[model samples]
Target: MTRCRLCGSAALVSVVDLGATPPCESFLAADQLDEPEPAYPLHLRVCTDCWLAQIPPLITPEETFTQYAYFSSYSTSWVEHARTFVADAVQRVGLGPDAFVVEVASNDGYLLKHVVDRGIRCLGIEPSVNVGAAARDAGVPTLTAFLDPATGSDVRAEHGPADLVVANNVYAHIPDVVGFTRGLRALVADDGWVSIEVQHLLTLIEENQYDTIYHEHFQYYTVASATRALAAGGLALVDVELLPTHGGSIRLWARPAEAAGEPSRGVADVLAREKAAGLQELSGYTEFSARVAKVRRDLLRFLIEVAERGETVVGYGAPGKGNTLLNHCGIRPDLLPYTVDRNPYKHGRFTPGTRIPILPPEQIAADRPDYVLVLPWNLRAELVEQLSFVHDWGGRLVFPIPELSIVEVAS
Candidate 1:
């Protein structure tokens, strides 16, 4: 971690230290509760040299993604987003029946199913065996492997170069940013497009979205740094699009250097915005730790105040970001009591470090808790709709990121 993972520079500076917490997605089963759980430092640092914000690769992808719990199809909005992206991408690239599409980190075939529906040849390169199986079961051709240079080359050799490679919300997951980019280069045809969606560092900082930091996510990219990372693997960033998903994200349009032309004006505008926000300089990072500390303090104060009033606050989702917030603020089952999720896989499990019990989503309605702390707050609009029934009993929804917001859902 001393040298920058992207540029091999020794000019790393601390952005925020969230202390140590268990890997965010490692939910505990009832039988494994008593056993010792491993934890790793959840600190984020920025490279002055490359401006690549990253954490130490304390936990490897194999430890996290091989048997992953997250399934993309669970989110209604996300699935629609994927569907629309597929439709737009096909039209944007003039993709036809002869074109082949590939999605890296394609979870549960949430996206590729759309391509399949179009009668286009598509494959998913997913690392997790269980999720990959689910993809195959849904009629999507999927390769069960993590994306590295060798794996990318293997997929290219076997299936021929992809006409369109879609990597959404996974650009930050890998430790070797450069190698992953090379893998992306290998999978895509020389003139083919590679679309990557990553949480924008500018948005993460401006919006105070620190809970997204975890071992599974090694790097946070601004368009400036992302451009450099893409170039490291022989891909040139040619365009950029600002997205509303994941709080805020940037969709980078890249291609092999030979075909990559001048970057879009959108890229330049975003770069300017990042610069205006002081992302390139050390000043922007200076107060993030303090802001993060304030968020923790504000949340703990609210949770404690509610506890003292003998009011109950159950959680709405057992998301990884919620675990980070819980562990960082030292919240336990006493404060949260229990959380509920729509995902069946997490039904009987517990949050990693905080050990908050997870129950079926029905439990919230059954218990009629006073306030439901909405984890996965990025889905604020959707969850608010889903939890609108809470209004029947005068229950309010609580969101803990950006700021603590307590909103009443309509009946």
Candidate 2:
């Protein structure tokens, strides 16, 4: 039995079993295709003790991140999201040129570049060599190492405790939630805050966001579980904000527990909301696997129906979430054919387990497939706007998760 990573509770209830899957981010080179790829059980369990939903750590961080294929700058929408956050953070935190900012898992400096542009002292901790080098080239000082107490202390000693430590969307990727929160506590000044954004577990279950679960992501959090994990590291959750990014996420602002301050009403409101949603009970999680199974069946039926009619179907965005969906559903290139992506690094490569060819976006126009399966369904609006040219050939777009449906573009 796998103990809960946060509370060490052996009483774990199964949420959803995605079967065996390779590392979602492991996009393959043509040369490596002939070699056999290994896969591990992509199972999820919720802790009855802390209500933390997590996957077992079957792979190391080095295997997933050291030479990572993902770069944050590739997503324009995400960059703009970062820009907006930095601007808000500067004003809200009363940041000035003298203030120090540190972003953990700061992929490719997409966010930190804006910090530098503002003339504030900034540093980035990114584990991926490829993305870290890109961050440096973009003028953000970066250290390519995993964030832990030792690394955090070294950074604190050199740069002094940060006024604002940004850890957006990276908190879920960590396996040692306690150690990571401790690192956050160590890196921030007494008066400073550590801002963490993670996909809300309520949103994941309610919205059927199973695709977001991959080997790289270790845990999904509710405000309650996050509060417990933070408290263990002497950090206090002072505020919380719900964000639309990643389907639905909560941006938590925390400070050292030794600091004096009352948590904002937002924190209490969210905790109450989670309770109302039945997150505090195991029955709330029992039905999720049924919903996930239905989605898999529905997606397969859609693809098979399209193929039987002798129509073509391709995909857009070769994201890690997309890979999870494809591999879990057993959809291979023969059924969906090739997919397109904006990241040139992924071009000409194949997805990890399914081996779907990742091509340039131009492929969509060339083949003009009857249906384009949008893998990153969260960006459905932006992608629909960008790929509106599909209408020229009467080609339509489809999303598999949350339900299989054709997109209705505004005229």
Candidate 3:
């Protein structure tokens, strides 16, 4: 058995094996579709010691993130999520024009643009060349480097200690998660806080969001696991908030251990809740694989039945999780003819393994397919509102995860 990335223990328990899939964000061009594509194993294991669910890093961050097709600004809902956070963080930290804000993995300046608008100094560390260029164009000072201990030290020296460090949805992307957290501690001022947002492991299991598993996301965190990682870096979690974004996520506020005061009651409440759910033990991780298998079976059966009836199907949103679900289920253009994404970078390309043609959102109105499978179920509400016109043509919406079902559009 492979050792746990967090605690380095040999007791990594099986959670689920999604088989092999191409890098979830590696969308392909038409010319490249016929060529051989590499697929890596999508197996998940939970560390019995730390209770952190994780997958082996089959691919490096350079291979997975540097040339990503995803642009956060494309998702209006996600950008709004960033805006709300920036507003709250500014107030909570009492940030002003003189204060500096640094965001690790700040994609396309989607969040930092707001910080700059308020005249606050901000720096973004983005590894992706294309997305970083876009962020620079948007007037957010961006550095094109992955943030590890050394790079974090350099950034801290160059930009000064940050009053607020934002690592939204990025904690899972690092294989050296401890080093990444160390970087956060190294960069933030002694009394400053770091905000980390990650998809909650409890929601992943209970909601059957198995699609969130891929090579890019090396580790999944429970509150306990996250606390351990932060504590190892001499950071203390001061507060926690459950967010509706990313299926269900936890936004943890942490401070340097030396300066951290008594943590809010929310911390103890969340930890106790996780313990009640058995996350502190191995038994909670068991039976997840069986539940995942059932989802795969039920989904395949639904798609097969629909295809047999000659019903037309197309997909909405080409998020990374969509690629994982599509590749794992072995669904191709035959099952899903084409998928539409608002992000232009993905348009005119094909999904990595499944090779479903990616189109513009207007394709939905032009084709008016019988069913529009909403692949990114986490943003179901936003997608439903955006694609309301589907109801005009008697088209229905399908959400594949947590259970595949047709969404009943409001009249």
Candidate 4:
């Protein structure tokens, strides 16, 4: 993009360009395989003035999220993560029976269900009608709409201001960073807390998580840049927590400027780490593109070698990040055959650009594949446990990110 989406500066710097790919989650049905699928340039740029790493808004959330393919409840570990977060948040934020919690982008009520169990009134504001319907079916009150400034104010007006606003893994999804942040402010009480979890730019660069860069994720954030973005909406960041979910992420604790005091030591500590990594400038990012290229090269070489041996390599998850890797590496079904996923929405569908068939997880065990590439490598521990049955057939699991590694599983 010519100017920063957040800062309106023209000093955007290149990070890594993964050429072009279709919208990550746009799985095509078997009938549409013969039709043409569109692709867009997937380039990430960091605004020099604001230091916010972003991709041009080539695709909007409405295109991808309206009939979303992903359901958070499908992941056993992620559900537990949400349960733990709810329990911890109740204690940390002092949420009680009378308290009100609101979750933006609440998928299938995975997290808010915990709030309901505790008798704390909560509402989920979600854009996808299907998933939002699922949330309501689970007895979690939900509004089917995207979170913007006006929607937030209307929610506040109707349901009253929230005591704790939880927006996990969604801060990067919106192109209008300022408007989204302001929506967050409008949903929360003047003294209420706003908790946001996003993939930290620090870990994304350091860990070689380039696949996380897709059209839907408008920007990446370091603590320093996120703090500036929060200020635009009059929300003051007060504390920060490093999280292990989604490769690596940061949970930002914020409040209205009137109530927010000095930021916690963790904020300064993270900013220091970001600065030390040279993210504030262009030096830390210079080697990323080359490293990303290495990942693509190494993975292709391994897949090719496996194919030459007549060994089968199938994918384990149809995650969006997996599509980025699949498209970037130019891997087709020949290199890696049909993949499997626990999400039923992807079943019988094909991945966007690569056109690999998506099957049920049971297909892997049924076929007894030699190796199953775990696309959602961030869930290594949990997936290893779930796929341990692969050991019964002498099958191994492959993780393609942060370098390619094959692991043996024991039953």
Candidate 5:
């Protein structure tokens, strides 16, 4: 009996099976082309007791994040997002030179750069060796290790309790959610706040974002589910905000249980809305499998039709989400000639399961195709604007999920 990672619930139901797939970000070098890739069953299950959505257990953080290649600084939009977040957080939290800010999973110090510029003391806890080294190179003091209860205590001992702890897009990736939250409680100051950003599970189901399911993402969280989980670890949700980044996400502000602050209206409203929408009910997830099946069929049909017409089609963003979507749809180089990535580590490599080569964004300009499939559809607007130059050839952009749509760029 596989127990739910969040609430220790044994009543779990298998929702959707994405078949065997390689790790989403495990791009292969050209020389390592013949090396056999290990694939695992990409099965999704929902905890009937707590309503937590998760993938079947397989990989650990040590197996996944060590020697990771992803760098947050690669994306111009992400960098801008971090800058804006730091500015807003400083204003809201009244952080100053005396306050110490800690960031968990601070990839390449993309967000902490803004914090450090203000003369405020900051520390970053990152597990990936390559990305952690990059953060250190950027002059951000980062500890290259996972944030657990023991590490958190060590950080508090060395730097004192943190006044602010920022965890952006790391909440969903943690396998031991409760342990991580406990670690946050131990590291944060009495009046400190911890802000976490995660892809909202409600939005994932409603928006047909099944592509985000990968082994690395252990849980898909809702505000209600998250509140319950946090409360169990002596944390309370103080504020919540819906963010447009990462398809649809929620930024949760939490503090120690002793902090006497009223919960934000957004938190209550979202919880009520989720309850009204039956997110807390078991039937909500029971119906999701059929919706996912339709998406797979529609995406495959569109791609097949485009190929049948002899039209060239390529993908954008060699992200983990893209790998899951492509592999689930059984897309290969024969269908998608190649993919473009901004990250240098992935640029010359091939996507794990599909074996589609990843090249620089310049490839899209040099070899103009009839259609560009935007894989990271959540960043469609940003990507479309960035690749608007594709319009010179009268090419159209295609988005697979939430239905297929082709739009001509305004040149």
Candidate 6:
């Protein structure tokens, strides 16, 4: 039985089955043309007792994240996002020259750069060689290893406990939930705080975001389930804040068990909402698998109908979520001629499993396809604005999941 990673509950039900898929980030090199790619079961389940949503176990972190190709500095919006986060966190946490801040999975020191400018000491724990080297180049002291208990102890022994630990969008990627949280407890100072951002499960279900499933992301977290996992590792949830980044996410502020403070109203409000919505009930999960199946049918029907009409359809954003959606819906190059990506690294490559070609955004303007499928629907507003020139050709943008709709751009 595939039990819950945190609570080990056997009362688990399959929520969404995305079929077999390779790790979304594992883009192939041109030279290795004949190299076989391995695909694993992309099935998701929800634990009734803990309400933790997770995928079936397959690959380990060491196999997935080492020498990673992604760099946080690639996105202009993301860089600005990091800058704002650093400024707000430094002020809100009251961090200064004497205080130390530690960031886990701190890819390329995206957030630490602003902290360093303020003359505050900051340490980054990054597993990817390319990203770690970038951080080091930026003069940010970074340890090139996964944040586990032993590494946490080593960091504390050398630099002492940190005043603030920032773990942005990493809580969902960890397979060893217990060990990772315990490491946080080991590294945080008595009065220090740990701020973590995770994509909320409630938003995922409500918005029909089944595309977020992939091997690299092991778990989908709700605030209630996260609290259970963290408290199990001797941490207390002090506050929660909703953010518009990454579709929809919840930023949680927690401290070691000894720190006493009134819990934020957002925390209790979300917890009660989840319970009232039947997140704690098994039937809530059992019904979700059916919804996922409907999404697959609807998307495939829409794509095939568009293709049959002899209308050209191309995809936008070669994101990880897009990979899952494309592969699961059995969409091949025959349906989506090619996809566009802002990341230079992915532009020339093909998406994993689906093998759909990726091109630059300029290709979209050049081709002027009849319909442009916005795969990363979360960023539709931003993307539509950037690609507004499609209006000149009378091209309409199509969003598949949550619902299939076309929005005509103003000419």
Top lDDT prediction, candidate number = 1
User: Could you tell me how far off, in angstroms, the CA of residue 255 lies in candidate 3 after the best superposition?
Assistant: 0.8
lDDT per residue (tens digit) for residues 1-411 in model 4: 699988899998888989999999999998999998899999998988989999999888889889899899999989999999999998998988899999999989999999999999999999999999999999999999999999999999999999999999899999888999999999999989999999999999999999998878889999999999999999999999999999999999999999999999989898899999999889989999999999999999999999999898899999999999999999898887899999888999999999999999999878999998999999999999999999998999999889889999989
> In candidate 5, what are the lDDT values of residues 1-411, reduced to their tens digit?
299988888988887889999989788999989988999998988887888888866888888898897898988888999999999999999998899999999999999999899999999999999999999999999999998899999999999999999999998888889889988888899898999999998888888889899988988899988987788778999999999888889999999999937898888899997887788877677777888888788888888898999899888888899899889889899889899988888888999989999999899888889999998888787888987998999888999877778879887
Which has the higher lDDT value, candidate number 2 or candidate number 5? Answer: 2
Q: TM-scores for all candidates?
A: 0.99, 0.98, 0.98, 0.99, 0.97, 0.95
**lDDT tens digits by residue: candidate 6, 1-411:** 368888988988878777799898877666554789899998888887888889876988888789776787866667787889888888888987899999999999988988898999989999998889999999988999998888888999999999999999788888999899999888899899999998888878777788887888999988889998889878899999887777788899999988937888889998887777777786556566777778788878988898899889898888888898888889999999899888787877888888888899899888989999998787776777877889999999988767678889875
Error of 6 at 264 (Å): 2.0
Rank order (by lDDT, best first) = 1, 4, 2, 3, 5, 6
Worst 10 residues of 4 by lDDT: 210-219
Please give the lDDT score at residue 320 for candidate 3: 95
Q: Write down the lDDT that model 5 would get.
A: 0.89
351-408 per-residue lDDT for model 3 (tens digits): 9899999999999999988899999899988888988888888999999889878975
How many pairs of residues collide in model 5? 0
lDDT of 1 by residue, 99-205 (tens): 99999999999999999999999999999999999999999999999999999999999899999999998999998888899999999998999999999999899
Q: Which has the better lDDT: candidate 4, or candidate 6? A: 4
Q: What is the lDDT of residue 61 in candidate 5?
A: 87
How far off is residue 270 in model 5, in Å? 0.4
Q: Model 3: which ten-residue window has the lowest total lDDT?
A: 402-411
The stretch of ten residues in a row with the least summed lDDT in candidate 6 is 282-291
279-338 per-residue lDDT for model 2 (tens digits): 999878889999999999999999999999999999999999998999999999889889
Model 6 gets an lDDT of 0.85
After superposition on all C-alphas, the RMSD of every candidate to the true structure, in Å, is 0.7, 1.0, 1.1, 0.8, 1.2, 1.8
Clashes of each: 0, 0, 0, 0, 0, 0
Q: lDDT, candidate 2, residue 8? A: 89
Question: Model 1, stretches more than 4 Å misplaced?
Answer: none
